[model samples]
Target: MVHHTMTTNSTSASRASSRISSMSRFLVLAAIVGMLAACGSVPLPPMEVAPPRPAAAAGTPTAPDDGAPLPGPIVQGRSRWQPVRWSELPGFDTDETYEAWNAWLKSCERAPAPFAALCPEVRRLSLASPQEQRAWMMQRLQPYRVEPLNGPAEGLLTGYYEPMLEASRRPTASQNVPLYRPPATLGSRRPWYTRQEIDTLPEARAALRGREIAYVADPLDALVLQIQGSGRVRIAEPDGSVRTVRLAFAGSNDQPYRSVGGWLLQQGLLRDASWPGIKAWAVQNPQRVNEMLWSNPRTVFFREEPLSEFDASFGPRGAQGVPLTPGRSIAVDKDSIPYGTPVWLVSQGPVTSLQRLVLAQDTGSAITGAVRADYFAGWGPEAGELAGRLKQPLRLWVLWPK
Candidate 1:
């Protein structure tokens, strides 16, 4: 009888211990959910922690680096983010990560809800060594391969930049092409005037009568400025004074954007359809310049902002409402990737080869689809030249806080 009693006690103790262990795990998971909820994170699904990858041999480049991979793919609006190893990223270690840090900091200014919690640590690591920063990233973040929901990972990478142009505060004989502010009726109208209508229709012109911000000499320059969304203009005031100002995207006519370059390509006017090629065609066919300009129905409006010394240091504010960093900012499909997400971008071609970190801090009308991106090339002639020529295949990976 005594022996039977002792056996029962042993079994009861084991059951009690098992209960305690289960409760501990529950409490830990509850705490995590609370933290995520407080930081405005999407409610996480039940997660299983995977084993960390084995460490590579020191000095052996053949072996892959160790990483803590997430359990499964994260489904987004227009894309799927499959968890990947840090080592899977091509040129992950080769990039000068410090160069991208400045852009990351800018993103923290208006950080996405998921990343807002990490801004403090991000700032702290501003002065940290690249190795230290990299280590922290591997420890605290999960890298996800950004892929289309229905197709392959490969996509397109184009380029854009801020144009610098000379302008007059008011209309001049030479500077006839005018850039305007948003029309008063912009909100009430679902689709506003087309580019040609605004130029020719008296009613449309009357709506934008007092909205002119500045005028430029070349009609093509005005179109380029509108296409870029923002630019720096050295304006000659009525007082014969000159001041450099930033013309920021205020609003746009709701008409769909039609690419002039694409139109030229369709017409088979010239083989090369880059901005330079378009200008060459314009020079040759000056009589048909208006015909070329009217091809794209969309018209973007702008508001002038004073370019202070501090403001001039960075590019204009992107869609995320933060000043974009040259070469580190990218315009992404918001449905595919959220603003303020740290993205690993890789592309290679004759124009350039890029494998580095960039932020999804902006979006463009043309930047649609799951894998597509528009690389922000900053401002000036060199930037414009690069922007005009870059169109290549791209791959992307996004980093999420662990």
Candidate 2:
């Protein structure tokens, strides 16, 4: 058995080393769409805001720890900041700042002049004590409160993870499903064959035939791969060896993406949009799988890459072109938060509650609005589960260099 683990975001996904169960197969779809909605082509407006609020009086740097009453909140469009001392960032003093330093370093790799210069301190502090790290942050960074645009300061949190799928290098009786690479003419063609056309039309099938990268046993795996934009396929070579390869996003058919879960929700087919609910519906209506697949005309294509040891640990490169750092990484609408900017996030949701610092390292199509974000929950089933379920009240404060 060939098992390939793939990591995905709004623009990526992954597969497990073992074949997922009937329900597990569909969960990948629910998780990816639930998190990203395939936000590859979507780009947010640039965050060309005026310079940030000047820092608090030097010695009076307000960053109180949690529970300390905040001064009047500073409202910014859809978000607001409560002036607080760095001590107010909940777990700031306790966070493994060095753990997030890697992500920071990765961001610095692409960060420009003003921000890039701060890399030295990030690297230097890795060797410093945690107390020293906290001090360094307090000296260099300013914390703010995350308030809502109108009502209470609350927001949702969701999660996504890399999935692993079993596959064969060549299609066979059981491994009938196929994942294809971008056709040479994909770019020249405006809107390529859609989900339905690609599945049924002989012409469409013929066009993509030779482009097959790998074949999976479950059709849902293939569908999830496309929706998430990238994933891993476990390939069984003729030599009796299993090698895992990533199906990174190449491009997509220009058609607008429609949500199958949303469709079922609107049609009243399923009361809940959770993966379990979607899977339950699928079990009763196996014959309508194609109908569901074709619900969204947009189809994605992939390009294969062999995962190196380092690449296996981190997620696929995000919008900022840096590898995601699990809990420390988040995808935000660039219009509200610039990439590489540090942020203090606070959210209390049914699944999780967090009041900590996270970086705006990525962006997604569905991640719009001034206060919206898609958190990178790390890898595997655990991350996918969290990301899939996270759609809760969220609030964020920019951690600008003071």
Please provide TM-scores, in order, for all candidate models, with all chains considered together. 0.81, 0.78
lDDT of model 1 at residue 306? 90
Predicted candidate 1 versus true structure: per-residue lDDT over 347-401, tens digit per residue: 8766798989899887765466778777777788777666655656788889998
Span of 10 residues, lowest total lDDT, candidate 2: 16-25
The lDDT per prediction is 0.69, 0.61
lDDT, candidate 2, at 140: 73
Candidate 2 local lDDT, 1-402, one digit each (tens) = 011122222222211211111111144454544432222212222222223323443444333344745455556655666676654454554566666777888788888554777888787766765556656676676667555566544443444445667788887899978788777777766888788988788987877879988888876666655654555567898678999877666666766666666566556776545455566677889998778768878776667778898888776666677777878888776666777887877666466877666777766555556666777776556666666656556666787665
Supply the TM-score for candidate 2. Answer: 0.78
In lDDT terms, how accurate is model 2? 0.61
Specify the highest-TM-score model's number.
1
